[model samples]
Target: MKPLLRLVEEIRHGIPSHYHVDLENRLAIAWGERKRKRFDIKPRSRGENLVATRENRARIIYLQAQDEDCLLFLAFILAYSPRSCVDFKTTEFVEFHDYALDNIQQRASPETEKLLKTMAIRRGFNQNLHYLNYMQTMFPKGIREQEPIGETLVSTAAESVGNEMRIDEIGRDDRGRQIERMYSNGPISQVSMFGELLSNAIQSSHQWRKERGLGESTTNCWTTMIPRDPNEDISITIWLGRRDGHRVNTALMVEPTWSSPSLPMPE
Candidate 1:
């Protein structure tokens, strides 16, 4: 029998790095990369001379995944299942199955309904749908920077500064000291200002800046707020962006029409 990953493309898309498959949960994920810290000089531990060495720092980060279509389709398949299934026992599966069946009964479409009726009775779920990779391709390429989803506050900066924002505390790779990051979003504008004039302008824009569209969020929205580092010099601002899918491994596809829009979306 084909394994779950071979049966479901979403499960295969992220098997190596993004996530693991779950015959029960449909997917299992744990994402918090560990961080390390080091020091130049080591000091005494108990009033005696000690070797100078670096210290390791461990960091915990939160994560969220988006793969609704895969789950929904699975639910639709499992709805008509005669035997119990651990991989697809979610309430969504049962509900979507009924929804599809109801649509069939109503004769939503003569030929289409007939085909769905046949699929509904299939005991095995064997669709190679690459949901994640396809969604990644749909994302706009104009965006180039990404941050974690959250609310952020900043004052309006000068136009010249905004074009070339001087953001200090830029985060850098501790190991290579390259690839800078943000401690916070840049506070800048297209208008140029300096000294008190610039300060006053920023303060005036503070209200709007503080309350900018930092509201509710969606998985498709670019919401990853990259953290900033302390003791870093000012650097030019960068376009915010995101990688729709992790490219740790090449996507193995089962069908070309895996994530086709023509497919029905069972709620």
Candidate 2:
């Protein structure tokens, strides 16, 4: 699985990209324009990537995703909004006209349907925390509770010693800190900002770890969260395994970068 931002395009059969703005707006409305803007909800070309390091202009970037990588980002920005707020059925936007139908139909694939259904069944009740707890239970051995390292590590827990275990940590940065506070207080209305990315990162790490023959029946996941620069995007580093102690390297660095000068609307 590619980045959740990228996997989203795999579901887009032939819808024009411009209509995606409607989907982005829907998220802005659901999560509030403030969060939407804070997360940089608007999609941009690969080369169009911008880091707001200036005063009061800071924003978060996921995975340093490039242009070709962002081709599917709109798909996520749209699908996630509905999945987080109302439900998958609400992804359709009549204002976009017939293109909206194409959008909805394209996303009706078995995988997308299954993913959305799982989210509905799993996280529909208590939002992201319920879903997080569900994923934790999937570990071969349950995660062990651990104390936080000051404000840097809001929460840290490691699964039982096994080839298929993960060290989960919630950061203490602005966005992460807020998420921590929300979870400690009560049920949150939406999924954590890093929820989708964390899932993909864990899956990707697991696949790579197994390829290296690190574990007997499963791969290991070493996830650590350290406070990061508020102005910088959150960075996730996946280690091969406890014994390997090496970063899982891939060809993503050399992937071809391409982009359309303009998006052609489908007839």
Candidate 3:
């Protein structure tokens, strides 16, 4: 039998009778058909040092039981790993399964858990790298700069310095140390003034889609903001479409698509 089919069967057997499967979306939804009952399933402690180290590591696993997608299992695992230090190799699915089993059995050694976490983190980072590389290919060069406005600010400041200010003399003092003085008639603003200017610039550039046409149809519009500092720049992208699905569209506003290896960062 196919792996997905096998998984579905196992899930059907393992899950409580209160849950129903949404075959169209391949999602399982839990319902309150049965009287409320709570099982005494003791929570397992991973241990202090282990948990602390796990927190510091970059591997992560994000799972949503509400989603019928099989990839949710993998997503859950990746969400738990530390940031920036783990790798998951796509070709090594067997290794991933083994590690997952070990993790569930509580038989995973500290070292083994650490290694698995590292692999998961690396996997996520590599996936992001691949996505960024693809985007780089799609977008031509010079479409955007790392710090567009920052470069402008620095260049403007440098150009204005000599032309706007004068350094007339440098003379030796009584102790033979050189003395220098400069004068400027250029405009200077307090930090708050600069901040206000930046805020206004961003607000002005923001775009909002206004309703057009009749019926129950609506769309969204987007705008770009220019930052005063190169490092502080930001851009917002929006997708607008009619919503026709039941599941919560936490990430994508449209219908849920197939699980891709490179998921976009959560907003």
lDDT score of residue 148 within candidate 2: 38
- lDDT per residue, candidate 2, 22-109, as tens digits? 5334323322212222446666544333321210121111111111122233454544433232222211322222222233322233
Kindly give the stretch of ten consecutive residues in candidate 2 with the minimal lDDT sum. 55-64
Superior candidate under lDDT, 1 versus 2: 2
Candidate 3 lDDT by residue in tens digits, 1-267: 144334433442233222222211111101111112234596434564444433323222221211112222423332223332234333233333322222232121333222322332333221121112211212212112211232222221111133121112332222233323212211122212324433233222211111121111211122222233355434432222223112224433575445423344334
Deviation in Å, model 2, residue 225 alpha carbon: 25
Q: What TM-score would you give candidate 3 relative to the actual structure?
A: 0.18
Best by lDDT: 2
Candidate 2 shows a clash count of 1
lDDT (Cα, 0-100) at 185 in candidate 1 = 26
lDDT of 3 at 98: 28
Task: Compute the lDDT of residue 244 as modeled in candidate 3.
Answer: 15
Give the per-residue lDDT digits (tens) of candidate 1, residues 1-267.
Answer: 123224334322222222211211231111111222334487346422211111000000001112223222332222222122222323332223222222222111233222222221231111111211111212212012222122321221111122121223332332333323222223344223323443343333312222232221112211122334445344432211122121111232233333222234432
| Candidates' RMSD to native | 22.0, 20.9, 25.6
Q: How many backbone clashes does candidate 1 have?
A: 21
Off by over 4 Å in 2: 1-87, 90-150, 163-267
Could you tell me how far off, in angstroms, the CA of residue 194 lies in candidate 1 after the best superposition? 36
